[model samples]
Target: MAVTKPFDTILIANRGEIACRVIRSARALGFFTVTVYSEADAGAPHTLQADRAICIGPAEAKQSYLSIEAILNAARATGAQSRGLAVHPGYGFLSENEAFAQACADAGLVFIGPPASAIAAMGNKAAAKRRMIEAKVPCVPGYQGPSTDSGQSDAVLLHEAEKIGLPVMVKAAAGGGGRGMRLVRQHAELLPAIQSARSEAENAFGSPELILEKAVVDGRHVEIQVFADTHGNVIHLSERDCSVQRRHQKVIEEAPSPAVNADLRAKMGAAAVAAARAIGYVGAGTVEFLLDGNGHDFYFLEMNTRLQVEHPVTELITGLDLVALQIRVAAGDRLPLSQDDVQLSGHAIEVRLYAEAPHKGFLPQSGDLVLWRPPTGEGLRVDHGLHESGQVISPFYDPMIAKIIAHGATREEARRRLVVALERCVALGIETNRGFLVDLLRHDDFAAGRATTRFIPQHFETPAAPVADDTLLNIAALLWFERAAAACGHDPAASWSSTGRLGSPVLLQYGETKTKRLVAPSGGNRYRVQDQEIAILRRDGCRLRLQVDGQGRDIVFAFASDTLHLALGVRDFACRDITYQPPAEAEGAAERELRAPMNGKIVAVLAAEGERVSKGQRLVIMEAMKMQHEMVARVDAVVEKLPVKVGDQVATRQLLAALNPAAE
Candidate 1:
């Protein structure tokens, strides 16, 4: 292999977990690494681990990591070797930005992924689809051009809707993560979805152009892994099943899709390589498809010009370090192996651990991680973006804090081991989607390897089931009680009469009920929590290192009475004095009040002081987490007074309105 350029320092122009992953890989390859971060990400895990970290700009992404000049300046300031300043863009930010790719090349730094030309071609689905069609890639029926084009005019769309049958998908020509996509089951649903998709496209990607395609029924998502070098060598690394999704984003992914046998795998792999060669793709890329039953037929979805979030699963099976290969490939080395070199090991599955409440429609949530712990054991690998105590799961960026991937000799074994790993993984403060993921993994269909794109909506209709005993919630609380008892200077074995003056009972709220639990230290790693005898093996400040399953495990708990706090995995729960009674006691305590969830300005209010409204009607829409949450009517009522206007500042649980309910 001939070298195009040679150097030794690599700069990662991104933040979060992926940045950290790159730094580790780069260091292992004998390269000094530089990291760039935003104000909010100054203390991020990746920055802390890098050899040299630079602050680019404010917390907002636009001024920081997305600032091409700022990143280039960091590279130049560090005196990095010209070609050694290769960028391993984790996934987001300038990972797929064609301009950024060109800028890196123009500045004499190697962009580790595909070339700028390849990025531009696959960056927009409409353009990518056209190329796929020309390359003889399996494609769904759709018009790959602007919606306003001659063949896709407004009248033509209506006519095409009739021609393609009822169900169709209106999507942004340049969209990712299911954004700018709408499903129209009939003619009436077409126009509104079209308008919404276009608006979302404009808002998300700065393009209002939309492309329409026929929707596939009972589709299973399967994607192929590809690696190409400057020398024109490309190879596919099998397929990954990513059918489990929410909001059109992958939830769980596994390689060697159960839906794809060797025959179909070969077919899909060949097609992916054909598409990549068509675009002259270099470095790591993915070709996504929607597979129908029997797996013989599939439709090309889109191509991601960088490493995917689920790349770990592929690595686990292939025993290949993808990042190293990416670097060597960028160094102008041909792929060390061919498709024949690829072999299936056992099985692998990955779950995205997010700071979201599954009970709350999987809505993004946040709070400080009182305790953060990643599961570690045989056949288990955890790639985390957060650490204990210092990590605050913010509403900014994606909610996923880490991804846990487990491997086994069998699919069932892999599935079972994943459940065990998830059970042991604990995140306190801010709710996590652990409970839902646990249920989904254990669900019958998932166990049977019979999952589809609509698996979440169809199979898991009731997603609010909390972990019964699998989690150490009770153990953590018990540990907290023991600590709180000691904190208040009370010992149960010494007798309550000895002290007489005791601490107040612990009051907390998981949802709407004010539950009280009395805590008394029983001495010797033991406590009485609501008459339940709980023995604590150990406690480390806020972290309670307890004996979970006779195994030394760490848990975090807060015992402050005024602010009730507990963390069940990654989700945060507040213990407030919100009391609920049998209607009689609740009737008289009405004070017209509106409250905020987190710190944010009120955006809009739908009702006036004297307006009447039905139950569940929108009262106000507050913007936070980059999304709007509607505070609606709990019961039919007449508006008494809205103290705060649309632009008022409010705190969590602050009363924003006074409501007088109409007589039932």
Candidate 2:
């Protein structure tokens, strides 16, 4: 292998963590880096990190990251047409778009990924399955017909689904990441599932094509990291088990699957390598499979012709810089290592930290990050795009804020390290699934390697809201009191008795519950709140050392106006101080209001203003963070006021519709 630099400058046509990740490796390899950002990401970390930054368009992905024309113009303006420039679409947006790849070639710019042909071959789930079948790759029994074509109707799908038996999977053919996917366990669900999946597919991937597969119940999701070069060398870096999933999206991924033995690894790796070779894949790609509970039987799920989100786990286990390899292969250099030279040294686990509330059906959350801290320690790696506190998490993109990875000598060690890292990680001011990730890693089924694709649905369905501990609330109340006292020019350390009276009672609201607590100073920085005694041992900005009921605890918190954001143990809470504000308004007036759950664009309005809807019927559908959420009628009602129509951008809690109850 020889050092070769095909392009002097590389433009990362992506944003956020993946863009930053690529910049790091490309800069280390001595290539000048350029990053493209949308209007929403003008001052983002990736834009700042790159040697040159270009603004493509607005906050919406279609006008910016996903717009190949905008991307090409940015490249050309940056001298891509004159000087040597390569574009790296990092794992999302237009990463797998064959048209984008071909456009780069047509413009005399190199695309730092697989060939356009390879992307097209694997971009469609139906087409890819057909090619894999031709290549002798084992596949799940299903119908791969073009469901969105004019001649092929829903009746054909229903017929084929019946032949495949009950419990089939309706999936979008044009994309992955669990979008446009539905599991149908009943006969009545098949048609609706097909329609919903098609609509989502058109929105997400610009295609309405779908495929049906026999649902491989209780199966493990295993994917092998495959790399190739122009010299025709291809090798696999082993498999990652992404069995811990929710809503068909991977939550936790680990390298060297516990269910795969040496022989099984060899078989899967061979299949993955064969799949890559069949498409003449260049650069990095992943071949995913659904491994049955028995572990020996496996079927091709799909091929992702881009760097995976869980590639860091593979990198940790193999001591390889995959991005660097991708750049090298795109530069026309042969692989530096052969299949025999590949090695896996340690076990690594990765978890995606999403800005979502798991208890609320994993609904994506958006707000200001008043405080953001990534844990640091040995064997821990935090990859994120957030620069600091006060960064607004816009709903224009994915809700995944960061990825935490840990590597250790063994699987147990890796699991423990990852759990500890997650516990120490702090992301405040917005609801997140952080605690959920910790609990999932510590679950007995996951620890004992018994988890499958059905693990979450089986054991953790209907996740409960985290119970607010009294002690934690007491600490929040005390902190609120001290801050208010300090703001009024009173000595926070002084006894409340010095003022000859107990201060105003603090009214804290968490979720929909409100509690009023009277705080009376008891000397020595101690405060009696309700019946609980809490003492502030030390306060350093947002960090606090406190003693509650003889138990010493350390907590991190932030105050944004009337709100107190704090992290206790692995959970984060945001409490609003409504003491001075007038309240007591009845909530019944707005009982029939259907509010938008988050900031998003209304993609579908299923009901008209005067239409009558039944309970549980979907009335409106909004697209946010690349996923669609349905707003259902809570009761059988007449849609009194449907203010929002399709294509309207809405804010969180913005009223989309109002209903009047129907006569019983």
Candidate 3:
């Protein structure tokens, strides 16, 4: 029989989808969920979904989610209201923080995760590598000891790198989520790479220690979901394949890995179980490994002491509620099932929906979601912390908005289901990777389950803005004209406007290109757009049914002061009304300036004013949404102006520096 549930209530010490996800499991188990939020997350979906909630601190994470003192205090204060007895740092903020876990223990509250000691042991990538090696787990050959923070001489470090060979990975000892990692391919790039890695490491994880590993080229990233209890019982769920990535962050994940077979799964699972047993782990954790395509060799990567972002796929395949298991283990229960009792039934795939523009370097985006309609049907699940409208996607945190998961009896069915769901979902107003994800899901390699880590960068290019054909453009022009008439208190469906005389000429601009179309009334709500005759069969707010030149079509459109945004199924188009603007003029060459891509704080100024630099030399570094982006010189030039200093906050397109071209 199962033991009694540990706590009557739990405080979720985080925000966003994962917090809402934890709240759902807690409620299902007959427990009250106390949610803590920052100032920015007021009325957020997670906060409203909680049984009780309290404001912890300001908008910035340092004062809110990352503040151990604030979280503990909130847990205490809400304990009276909701009887909160535990704190669950769902996934991100302090999920693996050893001090936070110890603080929960000190405050006489259960921490729904591993012990503080286990966290400390596996939290450091280098130390975990050593422990796994001692436990007889296979690890990649690299240099880890005599950390960078020890002030080891550059010569000695370079010597170690030389031993590890070129093309090594410089990783932060206590970092995850792709921060503080650099791939150096040559000796000349070692020092700067190490310096940047250390700086990012110290800022992100409070550790400056570095580890070097041989870069595994074109490998599949697979991880096992392992669970443990206080009774010394540990078991491994199946594996997840997370090979598709960008900037070292996962974009897509699925399970069981297409590349992992039964024999390979057993070997990897046994190794993961041994690792957890050796560390005396408890609750939910993940053991990551890099597998070569040949299916012959697998090497241990780092272990995540807390639950992973890709845990949903594993949960789906195994038909288990991982969050509920975490709660039961924290309550000091024994293993619910042994290895023989465990089973995997279905296939599952999940894609991360991020508030980012894939066409523009995948830079993070933030704004209100004007139209948020995710797909709904059988075998599809959307885990999110967003309402239908009026939800703000904040820039002070990660850009990911939701996780879309699909499950099926087979991998092909699962893949096809996810594709259809992505095609049907619509998220508008600000930019997102929605279109790009659809393309990836339909790619041949991805569909065939043959993708590797280099699949995206090698096989895909940043998609250009969708090009509107002549017919589509004509329809858009008509819709714009009708919307303008309606806004000015004129009846859009009136016959006089179209039939009596020539209608107004509408000028529309898409990107930098503009086109003029002459609209005239043909007959009875029917009109001539450019050259094609069209009739309006039906009209609704932002939705219209049109028949163009003997063909029927449906269109969805929204118009603002000077722009029209429309969607036809999965494709979207943006066109501007340039009717009032003057004719285009012949212009000279554009100015050379370095502009910020997103709102962020200036982290470093790498070049001095008047300093001559070659093309592609690093000039500035900006930190936004907890990720760093480096700006480089596009041409051989001298730095003419440096308007922004370190620690300055900048908006999108704000100038950071100016350059005067140097003699070639």
Best by lDDT: 2
Best candidate according to TM-score: 2
Expressed as tens digits, the lDDT of each residue in 330-369 for candidate 2 is 8988899988898999899999999998998888887677
In candidate 2 the C-alpha lDDT for residue 240 amounts to 98
lDDT of 3 by residue, 358-391 (tens): 7777878875565677888888999888887657
Candidates ranked by lDDT: 2, 3, 1
TM-score of each: 0.85, 0.89, 0.86
What would the per-residue lDDT of candidate 1 be over residues 1-664, giving only the tens digit for each residue? Answer: 3235776777888878888888878889888888988876768888889898888887556788778988888888887753466777778888999999999888888888888999999998988999899999999997676545575566666676677776898888885888998878877888878778878999999988777788887899999999988887888999999999987888999987988888899999999999999988899999999897655789999999999999999999999989888888887788899889999898999999987777677777654555677888999999877876547565456778799999999899889889988878777655678777888999999999999998997977557645434233344345444445476796534433345423235543454444555655555665555545556666566655554435565555664433445544434455443332434434433333445565445789888988988877888887656677788777778888777778664545567777777433
Misplaced by over 4 Å in model 2 are: 1-5, 146-151, 498-504, 583-664
Better of 2 and 3 by TM-score: 2
lDDT per prediction? 0.77, 0.88, 0.83
TM-score result, candidate 2: 0.89
Runs in model 3 lying further than 4 Å from the true structure: 1-5, 81-84, 148-152, 461-465, 468-472, 495-501, 510-513, 521-527, 532-555, 559-563, 581-664
Kindly indicate the candidate among 2 and 3 with the higher lDDT: 2
